[model samples]
Target: MVTFEYAPAPESRAVVDIKSSYGLFIGGEFTDPADGASFKSINPANEEVLADIAQAGVTDVDRAVAAARKAFSQTWSKMSGRDRGKYLFRIARIIQERARELAVLESIDNGKPIRESRDVDIPLVAAHFFYYAGWADKLEYAGYGVDPRPHGVAGQIIPWNFPMLMLAWKIAPALATGNTVVLKPAETTPLTALLFAEICQQADLPPGVVNILTGAGETGRLLVEHPDVDKVAFTGSTEVGKAIARSVAGTSKKATLELGGKAANIVFDDAPLDQAVEGIVNGIFFNQGHVCCAGSRLLVQESVYDDVLARLKRRLATLRVGDPLDKNTDVGAINSAEQLTRIRELSEVGEAEGAERWSPECVLPERGFWFAPTVFTGVSQAHRIAREEIFGPVLSVLTFRTPAEAVEKANNTPYGLSAGVWTDKGSRILWMSQQLRAGVVWANTFNKFDPTSPFGGYKESGYGREGGRHGLGAYLVPSERSGR
Candidate 1:
C-alpha cells in the first residue's frame, strides 16, 4: 500500500479587513438604525466572529424604501439610459478589479470553497452586470416593445448560499431597467453585500440608488411587505416564497421568486462511466450541496447501476473535506449550524426509512458545523431523502429500467428547478430534455451556469427567470396596458 501526503495551502485571510461592526447602507451612506438590535456573522469554517451586522426593523425598512423611492423619482429615473449603462459598466469594472478580495470575503462568510468563489461566483457576478449593462440603452430592441417602463422601487431579498452572485442577479437587471433597489441580504452572509455598498461608492453611483439592509427573516418580511415597494424579488425557501406571494397578492407589487429543488440527475447505461460519476459528484457536492438547483437525486439505469455506484464510491473517497480557504479542498463546511442540523435530521430520517447510508472516511473539523459527503442507496420515491431537498452534502440514489421511467421519476418531484441527463445518444438527450419539466436542463453536463442563460424554476420551485434578456421583464411593465 502507498500513501500520499499533502501540505495545507490556506489563502491569506488578511485579503479582507473585517469591520468591528456594520451599519445599514441607505441613500449611499451607512447609517445606524433607530432600533439598535444587531447580530454577529461568523465564519462557518471555524465559527469565528467575522463582524456585527445591524438588524433592520419596520422603521428601518420604511426609511430604506423612502430612500429608494426618492432615488428613483429624483435621480435614477431622470438619468439617461446611455448614462445608466455607464454606471453599470463602472460597477462591472470595479467588481473585476476587486475580484480577489471579494472572493476571499465570500468564501469566509458563505462557507464555500475559495476556488468556487474565485473562479465561479465572483467572475459570474461581474459578467451578469456587464451583460445587463449592454441592455440598459437597448431595451426597445429587446423584444419588450417600443418603450417599456421601469418599476419604481424593487425590494430584493436574497439567500446566503451564493450571496454576492445572487445580489448581482437581482440588482443588475433592476438597475439596467432604471429601477432603484432596497436589497436585504441573508443574515448569515451579509459582509460581501456591505462591501458591495462600498463598491457602489467607488463607482460614484448616485446616493439611494442601492440600499442594503442586513437582518433576519423579520427584516426581509418587513421589506417585502412594505406597501410603497413596487417590486419584490426573493431567492430562498419555497415556504417563504409562498408567504411573499400571499403578502403581495391583490396589490400592485410585482414579484419574482427563485426557490428550492430536489433535481434528478439521470444516467443511462450508454453514459461514460467515469464521466457520469464525476457529474454525479459535481451536481450534489458543490457548495456543500447548498445550491437550490443542486441535483440531489440520482437516477441510474438499472442495467449499469452497480457499476455506476462502485465508481461513484471510489470517486467519493478522494474528495477533501476541510477548511474552505484551502484551495485544494473539494467540499467545505455547511453554511450554518441550523442548516447542518436540518441536513442531519433529514439524513436520520433516511436511515430510519430503511435506506442505506454511506460516507467517505474523511475527518471533519472539531469546532465548526460539518457533514461528510453522504449518499443513500436503495432510496425509493416514498423515502423522505429521495423526495425532499436535503440542502447539504447528501445524495439519494435510485434506479430505473428505461428512459421513460427515468423521466417519470425525475419529474415526480414538486420542484422543477434543474435536472441533468447523461448519455451519448443525441436523439435520446433531446427526447429526455423535452420530457423533464425543469427550467434548466443539462445534457452530459452538470452544475454549469452562465450569465447569458436565463435561470429559474417551475411549479413549487417558484416563478420568474433571473438571468439573460428574460430577466429584464421582471423589472419592466408592458408599454401597452389593458383596460381594467
Candidate 2:
C-alpha cells in the first residue's frame, strides 16, 4: 500500500477585514447596544478573539421590531413586487461579489471548513436569494392567489452552525413575500449577518426593511415575545422550538421552527458497497455533522453490516481533519466549546453503554475545540447515540434484518426531518421513500439540498417548511392550504 502527503494550501484571510468591535444593525445602520454590554466572538479553531460583539437587550429588540413594522407599513408594503425583487437581485449579485469575504468570515467565526463555506454555503445562499427574487414578482402564480399578503415584521433567529446559509433561508423568503424582518443571528457567529447588513446597505435596500440584532438566548426570547412582531422563524434545538410554540400559542404570530434531527441512513445488502461507503461517510461527516438532517445512524441490512462498516472506516481514514482554512481539510473545528462538550458527553454515554467506539488515526490540534471523526459499532436501537442528535462528526452503526425492520427503526425516532436510502432496487427506493416518516428522503445520497426543494421537520423535529413555493407560506397571511 502507498500513501501520499500534500503541502499546506491555506485560504487567504486577507480577503476579510475584521473590525475591533461591532454594534447592532437596525434600520439599515449600526448602533451600540442600549446597555453597553458586549461579548467577544472567538474563533473556535484557535481560541482567537475575532471581535467584540455587542449584545442586544430588551430595548434593542423592541427597537428592531419597531423598525421592521415601520418599514412594512410605510415603505415595503407599498412598493411594487418587481421593484422589491430588484433589491433582492441586487443583494444576490453583491453576495457573489463579496462571496469570498463572507466565506472566509464564516469559516473564521463559525469554524466550518473554508471549502464548505466557500463552495456549499455561499453559493446556496446566493441561489436562495435569486430563486426567491423571481418568486417576488410572480407571487400571483405562487398558488397563494393573486394577492397573498405578508405577515409584517418577521422575527427570525438562526443557529451558529451555518450562519450565512441559515440567514438566507430565513430572510430571503420573508422579504420576497413582502415582509420586513428583524433577525437575530447566534451570538457566537453573528459576524456574517453583520457583514450581510453591509450588503443590504450596498444594495441600497430601503431603511427599516431588514434589521439584524445579535445576542444570546434572552435576547432571542425578548424578540420573539415582542408584541409588535407578526411572525417568528427559528432554527435551533427542539426544546427552544417547544418554548417558542408555547409563546406563540393563541397569539396571531405565525411561527416556523426547524429543530433537531436524528436521521437514519439505511443501506441494503444489494447496494453497491463502494458507493454506500462513500455515502455513509458523507452522511455523517459533512459540516462535521452539524446539519440538522445529518444521517447519524447507519441502519445496514444484517447480511452486509460488517462489510459496510469496514469500508466506511477505511474511507474515514482518508479524511483530513485540521486547519479549517487549509484547502484540503475535510473536517473542521467544532463551532464552540459548549457544542464540543455536548458531543463528547453523548459519545461517552455511547461508550459507557457498551458500544464499540472507533476513530480514525487522526491527531487533533491542541489549541482549538476538536473531535476526531468517530464511529460506534454494536450501537443499540435504544442507545443514546442512536436516538439523540449528536451534532458532530459521529456515526452510529445499527443493523436491521429486513426491509420492514429498516423502515421501522428509521421511523422510530422523534425526529422526522430526513432519512436516506441506498439500494440497487428501484422499487425498494420508491417503497422506502413512501414508508419513511420523514419530511425529505434522499435516494443514494445524503445531506443534499437546493433552493427549489422545501425542507423542514415533523413532530419533535418542529413544524413548517423552508425553501421552494411551500416556504413562502411561513411569512404569509391566511396562507392557502390546498394550492400552497
Candidate 3:
C-alpha cells in the first residue's frame, strides 16, 4: 500500500454564507427558484458534498429569461456601450482585487491544482475581462458595423474544467456588447460563479444584468431550449454540442458551440527533442489533461521514436501527483467519477487493441479521483486512444515517416480545435500550420492561449470563435452587420 499525506483545505473568508440551497441570482440578488428544488455540488477531490445549489427547471429558466429580457429592454440595452464598458472595467478590477479568494474557491470546487488556479486560471480570468473591457466602447472600430447593437439576452453554459475563466469568457463579451445574461456554470463547479455573483454585487452592476442558476443536465436543457433566450453559448462534449445545434435548428436564436478535441502534437526528426518533450508534457498533462485542446495524440518521426519515448517516460516519472492545493503537485485529481470511468474504459480499449501502455512508478493519493500519467505506444490511427478524447493524462504515440505523413495522420480526426508542431525548420512549421485544419496551431510550443487571439474549432469540434474580435459576433444583432 502507498501512503500519502492529505492536508485539510484552507478556510475561506468570502461569505460562503449562501445556504446549502443556493437560489438563482436574479435582479442583483439571489432569489429562490420558481420550483424551489436544488441539487448537490460535490468536491471531486474527496467526493464530499459541498453544497446544494438551486436546480433551475423549465419554469425557472423561463423566469430567468424573463428577468434577462426585462433588463435588456428596460436598462442594459438602452445603456451606451461606453457606459457598459465602465461596468466591465469595474468587474475586472474586482476580479483582480479578489483574485486569491476566487482562485481558492475555484480550485476547491473544480479539483484543479491551486498553483494553477492562482497563477494560470485566475490571472487569465482577469486578463479576459481586461481584454474585453477595452473593446466595449470600441465596437465601431471592431468592423462589425456602423452601430453594433446588443443581442437582447444570452444563455451560456460552461463546463467544469476552468470555472472562473469560462464565466469570464461568456459574461465579459456579452456585457461588453451591452447584453444581459443568464449564465449556467457546470453543476460540479458552481461555487466560483456564485462567488462571481457577489463580485457583480460589489461592482454594483444593474439588476438582472447577470443571473446564475446552478443545476445538472436537465437545467442546462431548460436554459438552451427556453424560447426567450436570444443566444446560446456552450462548451462541453461534442455530443452535447451537436444536440444543442439540432435543438436550435431552424430557429433564429443565435448559438455558438466550443466542443471537444483530440489534438495532435507532431515532432519531426529535426526538432529539438528536449523542447518537444517539454511541449508534449505541458500539452497533454497540463490541467490533468482536462483541457479541450489537449494534445493527447503525439505523432513523432520514426527516426527519433526510441530516444523521445525514453526521455518522455523519465520526465513523467518526476511529476508530482497529489493534493490539488499543493503548490508542488503537477497533476491533480480527475474531474469526476464519470470522467474517470470514461478515461479508464478508453484506456482499456487501447490495451485490448494491442497498443502497449506505460505509466510512471509513482503512488497516487487515496482519497481523490486519480489516474497515473499514462502513455500508449504502437498506436495506429484506428486505435481508440488515438481517436477519442480521453480528457485525462493519457498520451498515444504514433510514429510517422515523413512530414506529409505526419500531417495526414494529425488531420485524421473529426476535431479541429488545436495542433502542435515541433521542428527547427521554419518552412516546415509554416507548411504544417496551413495543412493542419485546426484553429490554433502551436509551432515549437503547445497549449499556449492568449486573450487577444481567437480560438474555436472546425468539424465536430464545433463552430465560431471565442476570443478577440470574432467573439463579438455572438453578442451582436444580425442587422448590425448584415446589410449596408
Candidate 4:
C-alpha cells in the first residue's frame, strides 16, 4: 500500500481564508496558467469570494493533453494491474482519512448542507475508490475479454452537482485501467477539485497522470474537441450532452455522457406510506433538487393521492432550511444566481401551463439565493414542469391508477437516467424494475448511490455508465480476438 501523512490544517470558522488563488494541476504539480489570467470562484450561499481559480485557455488545455499523453505512454499505461490497484487503494485511504476536511470544503464551495457533504458525498467518494481498486487486477473476470488496453488520454468534463464524487468516478477507474486523464470541473465549484490536486500530491501519484483545468464552458469545449484526446466523458445538461455527441460525430474518439433526468418516484397504495413520503421528500428536496437523477416527478396511486400529498406537505414544513455549514440544516442555498433564475423561470412556466403551485410556510434567508420547498399538483402530462428539467427544489405530482399507467408516465420523457419504485410486494417491485427504462432503478429507495454500481443514462438522458466494470469500457480499447 502507498503511504502518505496529512497534518490536519487547523479548523477555522473564518470561511474565506482557507482557499486562495488556485493554479492548474498538470503533471501532478500546481502551476500558473500559460496566459496568467484567472477567474474568481464565489460562495453562492453569501456571494463571498472563495478563490481566484486559474482560467485555463486553449494553450493550457494543450499542455495538459501533452502531459497526459506522455504519462499514458511512458508510465501509467505500462504499470501492471496489481501496481495500479495499489495507487487507487492509496487514494481511497487518503480520502477517507481526510474526509472531514474534504466535507467542509465541499459544503463551503457547493452550498450543500454540511450533514450531507459529511455523510453522503464524502463517504461515497471514498467508497468509489475502494470499489474500483478491487477491480484493477481482475479484468479477466469482468465481462470484457482479456488483454484490455488503455485509451491513451481521457478528456472529461463534470458538472457542479457532485464535484469530488464525479472526479473520483472519472479518475479512479481511468487510473485503475492504466489510462491518464485531463479533467475540467465546472466554473461554479472548482474548489473541491483543486483540493483533490493536493491529495494527489500527498499520495505521490505520478506526474502527468491526472490534470485538472479550471474554467467555464469554453475550456470544456476545447478539451472535448481537441484532436489529441482519446476519449471524452461528461456529466451535465441534456442540451449540452447532445452538442458534445454531435461535435464528436465522425471522429475516432470514444464518448460517454451522464446527463439530466426527471425520474418518477412511484408510490403504490400498498407501500409503507411514511417511508414512501420520506423517500419522496428526499428524492426531490435533496441538494436543493439540483441532482440530475432527482425524483422530480411523484406518481401516487389514485386511491391514496390526497392522503399522501397531505403527509408530504407536513414533512416539508418540518425540514430545517438555513446556512449550508450549519450542522442541523436540512436544505441549503441555491448554487448560483444563474441557477436561481433558471428555477424561477421554469416554475413560472409550470404555473402558466396550468399546474397548481404550493410552497411551505417558511421564511427564506434575507440574503443569498434561496427558494422554499415547492410542489405543483394537478400537473398534466403536457406541462413544462412535467416535460422540462427544473433542477431545483420543486416537485410535480401526478396520480396513476395502475402499475401500467405509472410505467407509461415514468417513461414519457426523453430522459431515462433514474427511477424510484415504492411497494411492499417483492414481485411487484421486481416487475416494476424491469419495466422502467432508466439506467438506475431504486426499489423502495430513492436517490441511493454507490461507487460500485454503474451510473449513467439512456435515451436523451445520455449514454455510457460512469461506475462499476462498465465504466472501464470508456477508458479502454480491446484488441480483436485472434481466432476471429
Candidate 5:
C-alpha cells in the first residue's frame, strides 16, 4: 500500500480559536457544570486533545430544563412571532458569516472531510434556519389552523455524525413555533453546538431561549426524562432511540426519533450506468456512510449487476482517502475509536458470512482512526452486513432478477428510512417508488437533502418527519379550528 502524505497545515487550524476548555451554555451565558465534572474532546483525525468539555450532571440538566421552561413562560412564548423570526434571521446570517470557521471547527471536531462540512453540512445548517425563519410569522397558514400552541420546553439530543446540521433541524423548528430549547450535543462532537450557542449570543437571542448542555448518554437520558420538557427530538442509533421512547412512554411529552437505517439503492437494467455508478458511490460513501438514511445496500438488476459492480470498483479506486483538510480527499477518518471498532467488526462479519469483499489500493493515516472505502459482492439477504446497519463507508451488493424481487428484498429489512431507484424509464421509477416502503424515495439520485422537503422513515427506522411544514407540526398543537 502506498502511504498518503498531506500538507502540514491547511488553514483549518488558524481559522478558528478553539478554547482550552468549554463550559455549558445556559441561560444565554457560558456556565461551569454544577458538579464540576469534565471530559476531554479530542480530534479523531490524530487523537489530539482538543478541549476540556463540561459534563452536565443531574443538577445541570435540571437547571437547563428550568431555564428553558422559564424562558418559555416569561420571554420566548410571550414574544410576537415576527420578533422571534427576526432573531432566527439574524442567527442565519451569522451562520453564513462564520461558515468557513464553522466548517473548519466541524472537521476538527467530527472527522468528516472539510469539503462536506464546508459545502453540505454548513450550508444546510444555515438554510434550515433561514427556511424556518420565513415560516415563523406565517405559521398560522401552515395547515395547523390558526394560533397553534408551542410545545413549551423541547429537549433535543443530536448525534455526533452531523452535529451542527442536526442542531439546526431541532432548534429552528422549535423556536419558529415559539418553543424554548434545552439541547445536548453528542459527546464526541460538542464544539460546533457550543459555537452555535455563541452565535445565539451574537444574535442577542433572549436568555434561556436556547441552552446547550454538554455530556454523554446519561446527560441525554436526563434531558429526555426531564418532567418539565414538553417535547423531545433526537437523531441517533435505533437502540438508544427505543430507550428514549420508553423513557417518555405514558407521559405527556411528545418525542420524535430519527433513528437508524439500512437503505436500499436499487439500479434497474435500464439505469444510466454512469449516473447510477455515481449514485451508488455517493449513497454509501457520503459522510463515511454514517448517515442514518445511508443507502448501504445496493440492489442492482442481475443483467447489469456485473457492469455496475465493475464501475463502482473503478470509481472507488479514484476516491482519495487521506487528511480531511485536503481538498482532494473524498474519504476521511472514522468519527471515533468506538465507532471504528463497530465498523471493523461488521465488515469482518460480512467476510465470515461468505461475502466477497474488495478494496482498491489505498493508504490510511497511521495516527488516526481511518477505514478505506470497501464493498462486498456475492452478499445475500441473510448476511449480517445486509441486515444490520454498519454505519461506515462500506457497501453491500445484492442482485435481483425482477422488480417484484427487488421490492421484496428492499422491504425485507426492519428499517424503512430511505431508498433510491435509478432508471431511464420514468414509469419504472414511479412504479418502484410507490412499491418501496421507505419514507423518501429518490428516482435517479441519492443522498440529496433539502430544507424545504420532509425527511424521515418507516418501521424500525423510527417515525416523525424532520423537515418542511410536516416538521413544524411536531412542535405545535393544532387549534380547535373547523378544519385541520
Candidate 6:
C-alpha cells in the first residue's frame, strides 16, 4: 500500500482567552466561595492548566439557591412569557455570535475535537435555546394544559460530555417556562458554563435569574438537597442518578435525569454494509464514545458478522486521534485522567474474561489522557464488557442467529437509554423498534440529536425527557383551574 501524508489544520487557540482563576457565578456576579476551596481545570489533550475554578460548598449552594428563589419569586415569575422569551432569544443570538469562542473553549476544557465542539456542540447549544425560546408564550398549547405555572427554582447538574449543550438542555426549558436556575456544570468542564453566565449578563437578563456554580460531587449534593430548590435536573452516571432520586425522595421537588447506557447497534445480513459500518463507527467512536447514548454494544447477524467486523475495523483505522484543537482530528483525548484509568481497567477486565480485543495501529500522545478506538469480538452475553457502560471508544461485538435472539440480547441490559437497528427490511426495522426497550431508537442512523426531539431513557437510565414540548413539562406545574 502507498502512504500519503496530510497537512495539519489546527484551530486557533487565540479565539478563547482563559482567566488565571475564576469564581462562582452567583446572583449574576462572580463571587468567591465561602470556604475558599478551588480546583484547576486542565486541557486533557496536553494536561495544560486551563483555569482555577471555585469549589462551591454548603454556603455557596445556599446563596445560589436563595438567589434563584428570589429571582423566581420576585422577577422571573412576574415577567410576561413574551418578555422571558425575548431574553432567551437574546441569549441564543449571543451564543451564535460567540460560537467560535465557545467552541474553542469547549474543545480545550472537555478534550473533544474542535470539529465536534464547533460543528456539533456549539450549534446544538444555540439551537436548543432558539427552539425553547419560541415555546415561552406557547406553553398554553403545549398539551400541558392552559396557564401552566413555573416550578420556582430549578437546580440543574450536568455532565462533562457535552457541557454547553447539556446546560442548554437544562436551562432553556427552565427559563422558557419562567423558572429561575442554579446550574452546576461538571467539575472538569465548568468554563463554558461561566462563559454562559457572561452571556446571560450581556442579554441583560435579570440578576439571580440564572446562576452557575462550580464544584465536585459534594457541591452537587448540596444543591440537589437544598430545600428551596423546587426542581432538579441531572445528566450523569446511573449510580449518581439513583442517588439523586434517593435524595429527592419524600420531597415535593420534581427531578429529571439523563443517565448512562450500553446501547446495542444491530446490523442484519441484508443491511447496507457500507452505511451500517459508518453507523457502527459513528455510534461507538463519536466523541470518543463519552456519549450517554453511545452504541457501545454491537449485535450482528451470524450470516454476515465477518463482513461487518472487517468494514468496521477498516473504518476505525482511518480515524485520527490527536490534538483536540486540530480541525481535522477525528477522535480526541479522554475527558480526564480518572476516566482514562477507568477505561483501561475495564478493557483489562474484558481481556481477562476471554474476549478478543483489537485496536488500530494508532500512536496516542504521551503527555495527556488518550485511548485508541477499541473493539471486542467473541463477546458473550455474560461478559462484563458486553453489559457495562465503558463510556469510551470501545465496542463489544456479539452475534445473533435470529431477530428474536437479537432483540433479546439488545434488551438484556439494565439500561434503556438508546439503541440502533440497521436493516434494509422495513418490517424488521419496525419490529425491532417496537421490541427494543430503549427510549430512543435509531433505525438507520446513529447519534443524531435535535432540539425538537425528546431524549431520555427508561429503567436504570433515569427518567423524564430533555427536549421538545415534553421537556417543557418538566419545569412547569398545571394551574388548579385546569382541573385534571
lDDT of 3 by residue, 376-418 (tens): 9999999989999999999999999998899899999999999
After superposition on all CA atoms, what RMSD does each candidate show versus the true structure?
Answer: 1.4, 1.2, 2.7, 5.9, 1.9, 1.0
Residue-wise C-alpha lDDT for candidate 5, range 178-209, written one tens digit per residue:
99999999999999999999999999999999
| Model 3, global lDDT | 0.88
Candidate 2 deviant stretches above 4 angstroms: 478-484
What are the lDDT scores of the predictions, listed in order?
0.94, 0.93, 0.88, 0.89, 0.93, 0.94
State the lDDT of candidate 2 residue by residue for 1-484, as single tens digits. Answer: 8878978999999999999999999998999999999999999999999999999998899888889999999999889889999999999999999999999999999888999999999999999999999999888777786678888999999998889999999999999999999999999999999999999999999999999998899999999999999999999999999999999999988999999999999999999889888888888898999999999999999999879977888899999999999999999999999999999999999999999999999999999999999999999988999999999999999999999999999999999999999999999999999999899999998889999999998889899999998998888774454454
lDDT of 2 at 319: 94
TM-score-wise, the better of 2 and 4 is: 2
TM-score of each: 0.99, 0.98, 0.95, 0.96, 0.98, 0.99
Candidate 4 to truth, TM: 0.96
Q: Which 10-residue window in model 5 sums to the lowest lDDT?
A: 3-12
lDDT of 6 by residue, 1-484 (tens): 9988668999998988899999999999999999999999999999999889999999999999999988888999999889999999999999999999999999999999999999999999999999999999898988777889998999999999999999999999999999999999999999999999999999999999999999999999999999999999999999999999999999999999889999999999999999999999889899999999999999999999989988888988899999999988999999999999999999999999999999999999899999999999989999999998999999999999999999999999999999999999999999999999999999999999999999999999999999998899899898766566
Model 5: lDDT equals 0.93
- Model 1: how far is 13 from its true place, Å? 0.7
Tens digits of per-residue lDDT for model 4, 290-395? 9999999999999999999999999997887778888777888899999999999999989998899999887788888898889999998899999899999999
Name the candidate, 2 or 4, with the larger lDDT value: 2
Cα lDDT tens digits, model 1, 120-189, are 9999999999999999999887667788889999999999999999999999999999999999999999
TM-score of 6: 0.99
Q: What pairs collide in candidate 2?
A: none
